[model samples]
Target: MVSTTSKWTWKSPGDETRNQIDCMMISKRYRNALLLAKTYPSADCYSDHVPVVGKFKLKLKKNSKPFTNIKFDLAILKTNQTIRGKNQISVQNKFEALGDAEEVEQQWKNFKSAIMEAATEVIPKVKRKAKQKWMTEEILNLMEERSCSKGNKEKYEQIHKKVQEKCNMSKENCINEKCKEIEQQRKHAPQTMYSGFA
Candidate 1:
């Protein structure tokens, strides 16, 4: 089959001449899928031959296997002091009771399974929301303003400065709020009090 269009895709540096050395090839079965093919000599690739790019319409197949969700119960270690202590104790006991295996790989796997089992028993799985809870509405507004100011260098810089200031303010506010909460909960053990930071 011949190319749908004629174009020179390459150039010789020594002779200062151009030639169609590069091509965008496709199967006979997907000939209709070739939407556009063109050469760009001024693409700044720093080579003797220019670039030939093609745009094709094709269907992609999805994966057969389901997506695996790996969840870590970090909040249990921070907020649930009782569960944390229990998990730690359980881990220690299981680790100590583990006998030596002939293979280091087997021993490592055993240790991992033991710790996972102990923590799984103590900590409940929680599906966390995919967003930063600390980010304030004011910060969002400033970000929106910055996005709207795109292409205008002066406006972009002004909005970007405002965004930075708002972000700093939001961070300080979150820290101050957490500190106040920790202070209020200071009646409890120091560990639980500082858990607010987590």
Candidate 2:
């Protein structure tokens, strides 16, 4: 009863004592972003190292859009949609999926909107998002790549400008806001992250 706690002793094979031997094998996969955090093993430093693992996806700069084309053999399809003398579409098949003229017109309008959006409107926004996301990820990845993903500097400032331009953000806020982002990614993501733990 005097020394019950230290009384018991255990022993294992020679390989068991090695530092490289991961008990839970957590580091091997170390994919969880939580485990790599500053307070991973429980937020309370006074308490035990609880090992709370948080996982995230860097998304490879394919980032978020935050956010296809098909063509038939032209000849046959045009014949299928040929119109008549009185501006009436002569459908030899007559198996028109369109219910009514108004409906057809509305459908065409909607299609036009979609096409216009794809060709003109949506492309810009999508390009902006794409550019922004890529720049954001690139900045993050660069800082990540260089281990200097934090701070307000000329290079990063230029990056923020580009990203903001794509996102249509105001110049006033881009510097401060974007810097904050850089800091976050730098602090959380490790140098070895891109390469991996294997």
Worst 10 residues of 2 by lDDT: 121-130
Candidate 1: regions farther than 4 A off? 1-130, 189-191
lDDT of 2 by residue, 67-169 (tens): 2232223343335443222123222112243333457777676555444333331122221122433245444444333334336577666665655464444
Q: For candidate 1, lDDT tens digit of each residue in 1-198?
A: 224464767767685876777777788988888887877766898787767777889877899978645576867698888988999998878877887788989889878977887867777766444256567766776776787678999999999998888778877887898888898888666668877376
Q: Best candidate, TM-score-wise? A: 1
Candidate 2, position 159, lDDT: 65
Error of 2 at 59 (Å): 11
The parts of candidate 2 lying over 4 Å away from their true place are 1-16, 21-76, 79-198
What residue pairs clash in candidate 1, if any at all? none
Candidate 2 clashing pairs?
Answer: 34-54, 41-51, 143-149
- Under the 3 Å rule for N, CA and C atoms, how many clashes does model 1 have? 0
